[model samples]
Structure formats: C-alpha cells, structure tokens
Target: HEPVPTEWTRTTCPYCGVGCKLEVGVAGDRIVATRPVIDAPSNKGHLCVKGRYAHGYVDAADRITVPKVRHDGRWRSTDWAEAITLAADGLRRVAAEHGPDAIGVLGSSRATNEENYLTQKFARVVIGTNNVDCCARVCHTPSAAALKHMLGTGVATNSFDDIEQAKTLLVVGANPLENHPVVGARIRQQAQRGAHLIVIDPRRTGLARIADVHLAPRPGTNVPLLNSLAHVLFAEDLVDRDFLAARVEGVEGLAAFMAPWTPERATQLSGVPADAIRRAARLYALERPAMALHGLGLTEHLQGTQGVMALIDLALLTGNLGRAGSGINPLRGQNNVQGAAVMGCDPGTLTGSVRLVDACQRFEAAWGVALPHKPGLNAVTMIDAAHAGKLKALYVIGYDIFASLANADVTAMALSKLDLVIVQDMFLNETANSFGHVFLPVVSSFEKDGTFMNSERRIQRVRRAVAPRGDSLSDAEVLCRLAGELGFGDQFRHTCAEAVWDEIRAVWPAVAGISYGRSSRHGLQWPCVDEYDPGTAVLHARRFANADKAKLEQVDYRPTTECTSEQYPFLLTTGRTLHHFNVGTMTGRTRQQLLRPTDTLDMHPYDAGQLDLRDDMPVRVESRHGEVVLPLRVSDAVAPGQLFATFHDPARMLNRLTGPVRDTVTSAPEYKVVAVRVRLA
Candidate 1:
C-alpha cells in the first residue's frame, strides 16, 4: 500500500464538466492522493471515483512524453528543433502549393481557453484559413447554434447554483449521474427537497430513477413530445402573460405555431402516454420556477436544432427564463466547451459575437493586416472533402479527430488522402497515426500553466504542477516557437498565457471584460468588467443581444431520415461512461481505471431477453457502416429496442458502426440515434 502524503496541492479535477476544485497530496515528485476543496461552488467536499483515484494516469507507464516524427512510413524519436522545423515546413509547403482552402485545423474543447484561442488564431491568421473547429462541433454545436438563434447567445443561461432554488427541473436527453456525476448529485439533492424532476429520454437513464415523471419516448421523438408539452401548457392557460410580455418577444406567433401539437397527436408519434405528457406539462407549468437542462442527446439527431427550439418554446410558454432559478441550460460534455466556442473555435466566429468576415475587417483595421474572409469546411466535411481530393493538409491540436469523428474508417481513409498531416498532442493518438510528415509532443494539462473556462463561463487557473515531462512542451510554447521560426515571432511572442490573453482582450470585445488578474481569485465568470464588477451569473436577463428583439421560430416535427426497420431493428445511441472520458486516451492509461473500464455495451433487460442473452454475454452489434462484438450489460435503466454504447475504448470501435448523417446547420453527426442490429455472437 502507498504511504500517506505530507501535503496537498489545491487544484481542479481533470475529469468531467463539473470542474470540481481538488486538493492533491504530493510526496516528493509524485502525486499520492486527491480530495475535494471544501469551498468550491461546483463540488463542496465531495469527489468521484475517477477524480479521487485517477491521478495515476499523469505518471502512467505508457505515456509517450517525448517528441517523435513519422518519416518514410515509420516513426523515429526526434529532438524538439527537428520536430518543430519539420511541422512548420510541412504545413507551410502544403498551404503554399495547394491554396489555404486545402487545409483545416481541429481545436480542442478539453484544452484551456487561451490554448483554444491561439490554436484557432494560428489557423486563421498564420495559415490564412477559416477552417478551424473544435470537439464542441460534434457534441453541442446544435445547442450553441440554436441558443444563439433563439436566446441571442451560445451559453447556458443558468448556473448550477440555481438548482437549489428551482421548483421544477426538466432534464431532456442528459444522464448526469454517469456522465456528470456532481451535477447529477445536485439534481438529486433538489429532488430530495421536493423539486419536481421531469426526464425526457429514449432510454430509462440514471436520472430517470429519481425523476418524478420519466417519459421514455422513442428516439428522434423529442420535437413531438416537447411541442405537445407546449400545447398542453398553452391550452390549459398556464402561459405566464406578465413574464411573456415583459421578458420575451414574439408571443403572438408562438400560440398559433404550437396549435397543431396536441397531446393525442404527440402520443401517436412519440410512444409516451398522452396523459403522461399532459401530467408532465402541468407539473412543469404549475411549478413556480423551473429550469431546463439538456445534453448531446438532444442535439445529436436529425431534427436536433428543431428539438432545441421546441424546448425553448416550453420554457417561454411557462415563463421559465430570465429570472432566479429559471433558464435554458445545456450541460456541456467537455470541460471548456463554452469557452472554446466563445473564444472563436467555429470557422465563422470571433470573440464578442463577431463573425469571421466582420471581425476580420475590424481586426485588420486594428492589426494592419487583412484576415481571410472565405469560410472553410467543418471537421466532418473536411474529412469528406479530403477523401474526395478537395482538401490536402490538416493541422490538428489536442483533439483526436479520428476516433471522435463519426465513421472511423471513412475518416481514416480521408486522412490517408491528405498530402500532409501535423498532429500536436500529448500522445500518439488514433488521429496521429495518419501523420505523413511530422508529430509534435505537447504538454498535457498536468505539465502546463494556463487557464480553463468551466461550464459556468468561469475562467479559472491551471497552475503548473510539474515541469514538462520528457521533451514535451506546452501547446502555446510550440505554437510560439513555430510562429517565431516562420518570421511571425513579432506577433506571437508572449511570456505566458496572460500576455496572449491580453492581446485577445484588446482585440476581441466579448473577452474585453475578462483578465488574468480578475480571474485569479475564485475564478471570475465572463462578461466580467473589473474586480468590483461582478461577472454575469445568468445571461440575456433583460434583453437579447440582438439590437431588435427575440423572435420565436415556428418549429414543426420531422423524423430522422434513418429509422429502425426489420434489418436494423434497434436504435443505437453513444455516450460517456462513469469510468472514462471521450476516446479513452488519457483515462485508459490507468490500470485500475482499465479494470473498471467502459469496454462493453449497455442494453435493457427486455432487449437481451428477446435475443436470448444474459448479462455479460458476448454479442455482435452491427449497423450499415460497421460492427463490433462487445460484452452485453442488460440494465433496466435503458428501454427495449434501444442500445447504448460508449466510444471510450478503441478496441470497441463504436464509431465504425455510426455514420454520415450530419446536422445541416452545424455539420455535427447524428451519433445519438442510428439504426442498428444486435445478435448473440
């Protein structure tokens, strides 16, 4: 057994979106143990299994801490200088020969805000391309797009603290218990305090266990169910006239638009009981103050954006926004997803609500250089373009684009077609395998000093716990060195992340209020002006950012083109398991974590019973695109005709079986509901 530590370092948990502040115990140079900070708002004196015991991954045996280069179809250990020159030369040569449009950059949501900002900036300014995106593109791009369309911003309007005061909590398509345990615990606490909990999902999830009303509707049926709830609320005269008139706009069109969605019609389409729908509507409407929390499950379908609009309609119909304990909240999957989006990870975006073209014009006037106006392809489309011989080089930072993208085989083939691929990551990831030219070893979160913005938009510090392991360097350091080598050192020179942040604040208006100094204490939330000016806890409180006003869109129900059939009799949904994070590169390094890993499929008892299978039975699950054989876990939490799988294990190859259908608005793949078939192996 390990000996007790003498001192503990106060830091944040490296897992989950909860962003719990952790106090890690260190003995000499190694981490011994970790505990929760007693005063952190996200987690007060509590820690999860992963957060408490997963520190070993930092000093794991299999970590590739040194820089390596792939030359002549083989990898060779290389020094920092050779690696940097090779990466810069390869990327520049590709851009010089094949036009800037031929290249794309993939940012990371798990990275610090400063790192995300610089990565996107490198793609846009240095590489002279608008082909920049992040992991949020796959998980919550629809949420950001839909929220911006309706609420005038791309972030959650409510904080986790609001749960304590909410009278009703409506969770749609999010299993916080397993995915976001701290948030789930808070919801449970609220449930124990008599706050009505309503869950809308295709499966009976962990959250469903504590929900007062769990509507296990069929997959892709969110639009109908949400619309019907709005119908019931409006028909019953539960609409708050005062709240609607004072706080919301376009109240007239909302009533006429939702008239077609009756409870009976919704029941016929969605499989939830008409009475249950009515009861849920009544409970949500009658409850004085309620909040709506959604996750990827709502935004990873064919009609994802439309479903988000329907949920907004329900919130507006019941006057559940723009006040204490009431707002539209999306529980982001990644740690810094909101910050990444806000800091301009999207190709057509800029900090402070500026579009690429418009912001470039403004930035050109400031920096004395014209920025590129042509918008580039998104992550998924970029791969397709590459496969079709339209795109050439790709510079990926922090993200493992291969496994994260839907249809791994298709993406891998696309990568193979690229003339040059530059992967800058802490490990030799699945995406890094496609690097034809160079690979740069970058510092992991533990070896770096930076700032990460939590889901609440709170900008917090990530102090360097240790020196750069092996020959690895921070992403910022690598980018700065590359910029210097390319004769752009004058522009990229910075002592630390703060100096880079100051440049961003000077140019980007949305980030104008935030500063490193202000963020030092208790982590100030964004839209923060000064030390005295308290940061905004909730957004769009008085009026939307749009100069005119909010106009509620008239949304109608439309089913996904792909549906369950005789050959593909089940709907496949993908998500994170309690034991692991996305792609399982970081968390997979731990021996204990691997022992309790998410290398299996979770299915309902009825589905397994019908297939003549028992718990832990090996089964081959297949879809049109691909298939995998995994150990079955028959759980009552999920419903029959639906299967849940996790992409945490590379061995599982779950993404191989899911494909191609993407949101037209965001280019995010519909990973939540895909038609598939399962059989005993």
Candidate 2:
C-alpha cells in the first residue's frame, strides 16, 4: 500500500491571544506537523510550548465522535438528526411552558467569530430571547465596561507591535511570561533594547526578576497603589500639562479625588514602600511613549473596574493615548475572547458595541426578525436565575461552567436544576455530565474554517487542516441545523463559513472590508471599512470615539469582600500556569500533563512553617464555600498570608473554594482574593 499524500494549510494558534500563525502539514486525516510562519505579524516565527505540542489532543482516544442524548441520567449514542430534534423539542417545550426569557444561550471564547455570530443570532431570532453571554463575563467584563466608559472603546488602545518603540513598559497584575509567552518574549526583547520595565504583581514573576522596579503590593489593593502613583505625579509636577489641557477632561475631579491618597498612606495599605512608589511614578510619568498592559489580576476583584479606570487615568494623565508607542492594553486570556465579545455575545450590546435599539433596527432590516429590546442576563446572573427556578433551558457551546465559574458547587446545583441543557463540545465536559440533555460533538480549531480576533483586535483566519473525526461537525453547521429545526430555516441559509462572515460584514461595520481574500496573507485589524483602506493599528489618533477628549474617572480605594478573619486566616488566590489552561480540557489530554501532573497549593515558607506543613505533604484548604485537598508547595512567590492555586485540575476543584463575591458594576466574580483555612491531611 502507498502512503497518503501530504498537504499544507495555514491557520492561527488556538491557545493564547498572541495568535501565532502556523503552517500545518496533514496526512491521511491527521495533523503531522505545525510550524510558525516567519512573516506572521504577532509571533514572527515563534511558537510556545502549548502551541508547538498541544496538537496531539486532536486525535485523542477519548474524543466524542458522535452525538449523545441523556436518558435516565445516562448518555447514549445517537445521530445528529435525533440529537438536534431532541434538543429543539426540549427547548421549545420549556419556552412554551415558561416564557421566552426562560431560555439562555452560553457562547464560547474558544470558538470562532462566525460561529459566535450564528449562535447569538439563533438565540435571538429562533428562541426569541436575549439571555446570551460568554466566559468574558468572568474574565474581562471589567475591562470592557471600564475601557468603554473612559476611552470610548472596550479594546486595546495600541497594537503589540508598538512595544518595541516604547521607552518604558508598565505591566500591572499580569504574569505574561507564563500565560502569554510570545508577548512575554517581545517584552523581554524590548527590555534588552534598553526599554525600562516595571512589573506590578504580588508574585515574583519571571519579568519581575529583571524589572527596573517591581511594585509587589498586597492582593486586592490596586486602587490605592494607582491613586498613590497619581498623587506622586501631581505633587512632583511630572504630569503632562499640555496633553491634559488639550486632550483630557474632568481633571479637577481627579485632582480632588487623588489629593488625599499620599504615597505614605499607600505604602501602609499596600505593603509597597513609599520610596518605590515615588520612583515608579516618576519613571512612568517622565518616560515618554510608555505602554501599559494588564491581565485578569487587575480585573478579577470587587473593585476591578475601578482599578482599570484608575490605570486608564494614569495613561491619560501621562499623555500616553493617540500615539504609536503609548496606550492602555488589556492582555486578553483566551485566543478569541475579544472576538466573541465583539460578535455581540454580550446581552447588553450588539455587534460593534452599538445601542440595543439601533442594532435591533439595523439587524431587523437585514435579518427580518423582531429582536429583543431590553438587556438580558449575563453568565453569573443566568446561573443565579437557574438556581432560583427562573431560567428553564440553557444552550452551552464549548464551555465548562462547573469548573470555570467561581462557585463550582453552586454552579453544579444550578445545572442540575435546569429543565433542559444542550452542550456542544469536543468532549463531555463537567457541566455536560450534570445537565446536558443533548450533546453534539464539534471539531477542533485545526479541523474548522473561521476567524479569531486576538487581543490587539486583529482578525486572523483559521483554515481547515484536516477532516473532522468521525461524525463531528463544525459549530456553524450544528447551529444552522438547529436553527432550521427551530423554524428559522429561511433566515439561516449559510452554506459555508464565508457566507456567515458575509452576513457579519453586513451587520458589523468594524470588519466590513476584511474578507477571506484580504486576510489570505496576514490578518487585518478592525475598523477596516473598505478594501482599499488599510486596517487601523493604533486607535484614537485624532480624537476619541466619544468626544475629542478622554474622560478621567474619579475613583477611590475599596477593600476586598473576603478579608482575613480569625477562622479563615489566609488569603487564597487562583490563577493559570504555563503548561495548562483553563479547566485543562485540551492540554490535559496531551503530554503537557506529564510536566505538571497534579495541582498543588502554593504558600510562603513562613506560612508553611507556622502551620507545620512540609513540602509535598498533602493538605486540605477549606473556605466558607467548600474545600479541596492537594499537595503543598512552599515558595516565596506569594506573601506571608497569601496562598495561590490553579484551576486546571478538575478533580482538585479549585473554584469550589472560591465564593460568589463579584464586582459591583460588571458582576465579575472576585477569584483573586478568598478567605480560607489550611490543615494537614
């Protein structure tokens, strides 16, 4: 017999938001090799550990190759037609008995923009409900809310390519080295080129080891630290007076609010020295063309949005906006989380952040359906509503809510209470195991054709490298078929991914000109209105999206809700690692599991010694919500009273120990700080 012929395809990585372009070689329906494209704008021929080796999971033995239906609390194999019919009937029955508002649809950040657009359309046009959302609600909702309110857009103000031109870089609350290795490498390269680096994280991360200044403040104390920096800028006269006078507003309100937060007070509160605060402030203020970037650490708190607003205030005060080398950038966690949000996965806004009424009118003209007028429930609110017996049915796509939500126990109970649950993913995830009535298998990024928007808002193509395994279908195909079953057959006549993108272009003006032809060589950024018009790399060049000037919000410091108590003596924080991602569904199935086989509780030497806990000793961490037992690893990365852990392990169930405290404005649960007690097993 002759060996199968090989073919090559170009696509983007599926792991992080760096969006490294790759050339994949396939043979006989298998992905043989993946290499980084030398001319790719984001990575430039660099591939991280996950991106290089995580493709093995595409052919894993445990993948779901057929659809399944739950009967008598057990999943049984079924065909696509049967599964779609069962799911459609279940949803219709629930909506008929209850109201249209009783049904909720949960989209996925891991999916593509075309699939997300179809999912939301199906929810609004077919189900006639606005209860739609994605995992961004738990991760970057504060970023979206705060950035839009302050700078008129909820995205990065500048591109990652501008990092090399910056004179100084201020990274706050994010350990990009472990989470986003490609961007981390670029930051290191910029530092080597004489760019001053300042890291603001509680942990002694890789970049912090070589930083010119590392402000290791106490957890959940970002607002005061930022305010103190502003105070120093005002007192030392380091602020850009001309920029403020020309391109800013509400300066008087900011001055009055920041007048009382002195460096000394901030030092006492945040455990960062007053001298260090002053030096950081001076460097950040005096350094022209400085860039600021942050991650979930700055946005997963009770005062998350306020922290983002304060950071934006710093950038505005220092004249960092409307330039090539200076702006505020939020490092998105997932590869397509930004794209999913921009595709109108949120219930409050439509595509391109348009008003609900205006978006409904425009989409009605195009889609020819009556859309919902009011805003619907978010991810957290939908779960709460399900627990209260208000929400009846839920349609989840490529998300495991049980392991991802803050309170896993409560999320599981809510899943068990729902009347109907339809899940679509490559595997039977934790949430599906509890409540999924119909399960549809979907293909991986390597086996699909679509586009994903990176953190820089660059829309990149994801071409199909190989055929999908067995009877697995693409998310768009499944969604279209389900729509046909739900009486919206005429509206959803898309035959391929390109047709869906055509509809997206008709609705979203940001990427109207970005077609498959234009994106063949390299991905294009948003705001590309025409084919001849080059995409925008930097935003706010002349004026902000709202007004000519940016707004400086007046914000104050607020303590975290779960403070240390006599019973719960330590502050527990959750995060990700380099080898594993959220919930560890894909990476766990690959050889990446051997690198870090089990989750561990990280504590400082002082805390471990006081508790008589030794290295590699199994210990139980208990919180008000729940408890989990894992081996302890003593390290100096965390503070004396602080403990850290990751949620990559499903059996360990780290989120079970986290509570339901959330941000006041965005409902983003505070996964950074939790009150817990430790005991040796």
Candidate 3:
C-alpha cells in the first residue's frame, strides 16, 4: 500500500500536549509514513492513532499554497510582495485612522516558541500595541493564574516520568484515553501494577470505568467535591503537619475556611457520596506519593481559577509537593499552550509572566523603541471593542477564533464589524472563508524549524521534514518580512531558526541556558538557569518558589448564575473527541474522516426516553444564545440530565450554546456547563 522511504526526519508530533517523538518517512517530498521512536522520554515508543495516520492532510489538494487577497468577496492569487504590501498598507490605514490601540493582533498556541516570540514582539515593537493574546485565554489561563497565586511558578510540579513512581494517580476533569492516548496507556499499565487510581468527573469516561474510586460530581460543583476531600484530610488528621510547617503558610485560617464544607453537606450539593469522598481522600493521602492531573473540565467554568486552587489545596495538605511521584499538573489542551504563554503572548505580561512595565527597560533598550505603558485589551475584550466600534483591525494567526470562542453568534458579529482581517494559515479556514481580507499561506510545524514545549515543560525540537510544497513560508519569515515592509526589518532578520532561538535565550533569563545544541536529543526542561546547570525534572524539591513557602487562598463554592428552569432543563458540555483535533481544520482533510465523519450529541437513555426520543433521531438543541440540530445517540457514558458533544465540526457550531459567563479572575469562558433544551427536529 505504500512505498519505501528514501529519508527519515525525527521530530515531535504536532497534535496534543503529549508531544510524542515521531520519525517521519518521506519519499521525494511526499510523506510516506510515521513511526514511534523507542527512547522518547515523553511517549516511550507509543504513538496515538492521530499521530501515526494523520499525515494525509499534509498533502491535501485544497491547501492554500500561495498568497491571495479577497476582492469584492472573491479570491484572487497574488505575489508575496503585493500581498505583504497590501497587508501593511491596510494596517497602516487602520492605525492612522483610529490610533495604535485600536488594532488587535492574536498569537497562536499551535505555533512554535520562536514564532510566538516574534508574534508578540511584532505587535509591541512594530505596531506599538498590547492588544495581543492567544487561544489559551479560552482554556488554561486560569490554571496558570491560580497556580502562580499559590506557588511562585505556574506550571506542572512534576514530570510524566513520575508515573512510574506514583503510588496513586488522582485524575480530575480529564479523559486521557480519548485525548492523550499514549499517556493513557501508561496510566492503565500503572494501574495494572497495583497503583491506586481515583477519577473525579461528571461523565463515565474510559478511565472512570476502571478506576478504584470514581466520584461523579454534578456540573459546576468542583469546589464542593474538592472541598469535601480537603475536609476529610483535616478531619482525620491525615495531613502532613511537618510538610505544612516547613513548606506552606496560611494554615492558621484554613480551619475556619474549611469548617463549613463537611463531607455530608458537600455531598448534598456535589452529588458525590460522603462515604466515597472519605474513601477517596484516605486512599490518596495514605498512598504517600499521588499525582493530581486535571484538564479543561476543571478550568472552563465560572469558578475556573478557584477550582484550580482547590485542587492544589489537596496536594499541599498531604505534603505531595517536591517529590518524584506526587505533584499538581494541568493536562494542557494545546501542544504549545504553556509555551505560548511563556513566550509573552498575553496582553498583560512579557516572557516568564513578567509584567510589561518591569521588563520595559530591558526590551526598550534592546529594540531601540519605547514600549507602550498602557494596558491594552485582551482577546475577549478586543472582540467586544470591535463590536462597539472602538477596534477596527485584526491580525489572526493559526487559530479559528470565530469557531473556537464562546458565544459564536456574538463573535461573528464582532468580527464582521472589523475593518481589516488578515488571516495567516496553511489552508482556507472557517474565519478566512467569511471575513479574511488578506490570506498569508504559511507552512505547518512539520515544514518549519523551531521548538515546541509540551505539557511537562519539556522543550523539544521541531525539525523541517520536507521543504514547502509551493510558495509558502514559515511563520517566522512572514513576521520578519512584514516588519521589513513597516521599516523595522533589520532587527528581526534572523538567518535561521536557531538564530531566532539564540535571541530568545539572550532576552529571557528563564530559558537562557537552553540552547539548540543541548536540547538536540531528548530536549531540556525549563528553569535551566546557566549553561552548566542541568534542567530540572521535578520542581519545588528543596524549597517552594515563593520564598520557600506556599500560601493557601481561602475561597468558597458559589453557584453559576446561568440557572436552568422549565424552558431549558438539561445541561450541555463541550469537548474534543479522539478522532479529531480542535475545529477539524487539518484532520477533516485527512483519512481520519473514515473513522468519525461528523459530530453527534451523546445523551443518556433515560433522558431520551423522557423526551420520547430514540437512537439516531435528529434533535434540535436550543440554548438561550443559539440553536443547532444534531443526531442523537442514546448512551450511558454521560450521567442523566447531562449531554456531551465535540466542537471539532464547525458545521455543527456547538459553541453557539456556550455563553459569555467567564471566570471572574481569568476570562476563560465556562464551556463545561450550559442550560439547554432538546426536542425532535
């Protein structure tokens, strides 16, 4: 069925956060196949289904191989020079008319570390605006914000290699089997080795069915469920008093804060049985070193950051920090979500989460320009500003914003009001087809030379497997060339990817020691301060980041305001499926379509029976924001009165049901809970 390979390229998989090592085989610029590397530290020779067979989209016939500009709502091919000129001219016009603060530029988590660095640098150095953000604002911004508030650094406390040493694995709000298959296999193997497993989720995921204790809390009730676990730890005196005294602070106020959240009372609101809560807490605490990992299910809520704090409270209470087998880690959604934020893609900070004002002196001296002191709007606020006629232009890269953000109808309207929309991607996407004025064709990560940081904070190499198929260029080149047009090209004109990386090291102290030479093999972890210093695998070993002491915040469970009634009596949650990645832009063109063609609404049989429905029935699911029709399949994976669906299909527009209710601390929208009603179409 396939030919033998003439050459092979070793690189990282560009799909999920678990960046598995892949050796891609190519026959004269055509990808023949991909194989797993045995010695890869993250994956250990295992590849996910998508990683092994999803190369079909790389050679799809409909890819945009050249630059184009939309005229009169129609497309026309253009040379790179003219396209770049047009893009620069339009941006200049918008800036001249409404000032620099009126233009918004968005970076991408799917992009490389070098590219993301250049993206934010482009906005701050060239455009003179802080209106730049990434897709992480919709997912894990709260995870970082919460972790930073508790611990000094905001990332995973332990590496995935700790899976072998862990005596217990506490998984909350994540389904690794469907999302991170390679890691999921290792988790299953660990369970078989007699390690205890605790799963806390509302849905009966693949991990839950085999877990030692599965506690299904009602939607929007993570605080109560997690609080109940902490309550038991304190009640039974299972807490490590030595660990708390030596490493943590704020225990003096915790008794009063946790007194009201008893196991029995929390069970009434969270729906997790009191006995099961006590058992789960005991199993986790007694099992000396337990790993706590969570996903978007815990962060995409009205109390997202608060939920993260609550999860970390348990780990600290039992003295799980600074160990090989136990720590708190967030199962990042995007492959480079952690990297993008680390590279200063947010509007409020610079590299290493440093506020702009603090780093302004160093950057301004390096670039010979005055950095903007005023705080600019974030991604969500940019859209609201666009609709309100305050923002006029947008530069979007790699992500499908209209389809991926919450409240799709509002996003569409806000984008429609913008005067200029410059979209950069490899293919025609959902947003490009409708509102894109200039389309800059860029190569995929497989066709570029850069670095991607995985969920474990490991920085791996992304080598160029093949040359560009057509007139396409890398994202770094596009940003540099655009800067040239704007008369600031000399500073960003790097001869190679490594040269850009060298500049990143020179500017940021956190990644100063990580060079391409050292990270060539298995890659290096962050906090590598000097050249002689080896990277850190597990954080918080000798002392915590915050002055050798961690502080616990006091928060209470507050119900979401998006209440349900007779009109919309059911709750709907959205997530990704195993068959496709976000928005299905790349996977849709691949042969993976044969496995899963479209999205479907998964409902419990009892809920269907109450609505007088059956399997394969077309149902009209309506929320207060908008509605869509999807075929329903009666299944037991979800609890009764709860529905699940994937947002990979743009045609389904599942985000239409999600609203604007975001976490008060971070603006991450609450995608895990929504009130809706379903009926026969």
lDDT by residue (tens digit), candidate 2, 138-199:
98889989989988899998998999989999999898898999999999889888998999
* Candidate 3: RMSD to truth: 1.1
Cα error, residue 538 of model 1, in Å, equals: 1.7
Worst 10 residues of 1 by lDDT: 544-553
Name the top lDDT candidate: 2
Off by over 4 Å in 2: 1-5
Q: Candidate 1: TM-score?
A: 0.97
- For residue 262, model 1's alpha carbon misses the true position, in angstroms, by 0.9
- lDDT against the true structure, per candidate, is 0.80, 0.90, 0.89
TM-score of each: 0.97, 0.98, 0.99
For residues 460-516, what per-residue lDDT tens digits would candidate 1 score against the true structure?
Answer: 776666667788788888888887776677667788988878877787655577777
Model 3 misses residue 214 by how many Å?
0.9
Measured with C-alpha atoms, the lDDT of residue 318 in candidate 3 is 93
Ranking by lDDT: 2, 3, 1
Model 2's lDDT to the true fold?
0.90
The superposed Cα distance between candidate 3 and the true structure at residue 508, in angstroms, equals 1.5
> On a 0 to 1 TM-score scale, where does candidate 2 land against the true structure?
0.98
Write one digit per residue (lDDT tens) for candidate 3, span 505-557: 88887788899988888888888877887888999999877678898877798
